[model samples]
Target: MSALERRIEAMRLFGRLVATQEGREYLADNNHKSGQAVVVADYEELIKDVMPRIRSHKPPVTIALLKDDELLMFSIGPTPEAERVSSSAASPESTIGMLYEAACQTSNGSSFHLTSWDRDATAFSMPSVRELLSH
Candidate 1:
């Protein structure tokens, strides 16, 4: 599969995982026990494992993982516009934490991360999260 496909697959898997009750409980329990989250590392590992398959077919769309305020955001396409904004503003080190926030939120959790995914070269904006919910 192409990189875009791989990334999409990963996202879909993650989305499904996060949307489950068991996964959310496990993540919360682990976080409570460890005091620090390991999801970021796990996410990185997953992407790394899939990269080879994706690269052979096509390069993945350039996604910029971002932490905006309290939101975890990612760009979802191969548009120059998104790339420019991401490259200009976000750094690699921080993106993981941002993504983690989103994962945590989506995992049947109490809160929602305020994230936006803007398509490159278009006015369309994809918000990972819609509203903030309190537990």
Candidate 2:
């Protein structure tokens, strides 16, 4: 197989692991060890309200995972909805982290019908301990 094919398969495997953990009770029990962000906001509700705005504005969005103070496993693309908003100005990291949380909630079915403009631009999906676990 070619390098690109291998990379594609790897991504699919990562997605599958995420999907499996996301849908199953076993994964739910294991979620505590994963160190996922303790989201304080009503992300589902927020995403629902903001998605249309994001799509319309087409602001740049970066999908990212925060590993300590550093960002790992990230991807960048346009978020059209963000373009419409009057953001006073926030750090790029803060903005991307917010977007990542929204995307995660949306993908997991907590928030329905609001798809990200660029789901493939993952800032952090590689070498994740949870993703590497044997199912």
Candidate 3:
């Protein structure tokens, strides 16, 4: 498969997984365990917002995996604009975790990780994540 196809496949796999019962439970359990309320991001909006990047395919989008706001790993995020997740992300990290779980499964259980989708690969160098992603 092409890089774009691979990106789409991964996203679709993740979106499908998160829509399953097990996925919902996993998210709910994480929210319950956190004690602090977590807000679900409007992934649909995010997907729409990043559509231009996907179409041109000039700059490969990058997905960053961060734990407690620290960059852990990164790879190209090449999803197509047409195949967005059916629902908003369960948690900010859900997509990242799903992608990671499906693709990477790095050696660690979920504790605290952050995900940035469709951003420049160097997006995390800023003083704050809010600043990094804002660029």
Candidate 4:
């Protein structure tokens, strides 16, 4: 699939994962190990709130949703030049790790783990929901 198509599919998969109680629990459990942020807010409400905001932005945007106490924090910005630079480097794994670290910094001292979804070479190493659950 094209990169955009892959990203869309990833989002759909993420939406489906967050749509169920089991999936949410699994995500919460996996947060530490996977470093992907668990959506603490209502998925539908989050979509309603973010869609319009996302539409106003240009392409190559990065959106981060973080959990702080009882609130969900949203940080939307352009995908950094570092990301483009790192992706072209020899190690995509390191690039993904760097991205996750950058996302985590936005937590503002919140202890929750963070994750980024991208259609890069690193995507090949990501485990499926079933794979994550099986372990």
lDDT of each: 0.32, 0.34, 0.33, 0.35
Q: For each predicted model, how many residue pairs clash, with residues at least 3 apart or on different chains?
A: 0, 21, 0, 1
Error of 3 at 79 (Å): 27
TM-score of each: 0.25, 0.25, 0.26, 0.31
Q: Kindly report which residue pairs in candidate 1 clash with one another.
A: none
lDDT of 4 by residue, 51-125 (tens): 344445443233322212111222333334444333322222232224334444533211221123232221111
- Residues 1-135, candidate 1: write the lDDT tens digits: 443444455455445534666545543443322222112122333333422332343221223222222222232223343234332222233333343444344333212211232222211122343232111
Q: Write the per-residue lDDT of candidate 2 for residues 1-135, one digit (tens) a residue.
A: 443343344445434545764523433443222433222112222344434443453333222233232222322233235333322222222343455444444322111122443332222122233434344
Candidate 4: worst 10 consecutive residues by lDDT?
118-127
What candidate 2 gets wrong by more than 4 Å, as runs, is: 22-72, 77-127, 130-132
Ranking by TM-score: 4, 3, 1, 2
Q: Model 3, 1-135: lDDT tens per residue?
A: 443444454454434434666644543443222222222112222433333443344432334333333322223333333533232232442443343343343322212212333322211111212322322
Worst 10 residues of 3 by lDDT: 119-128
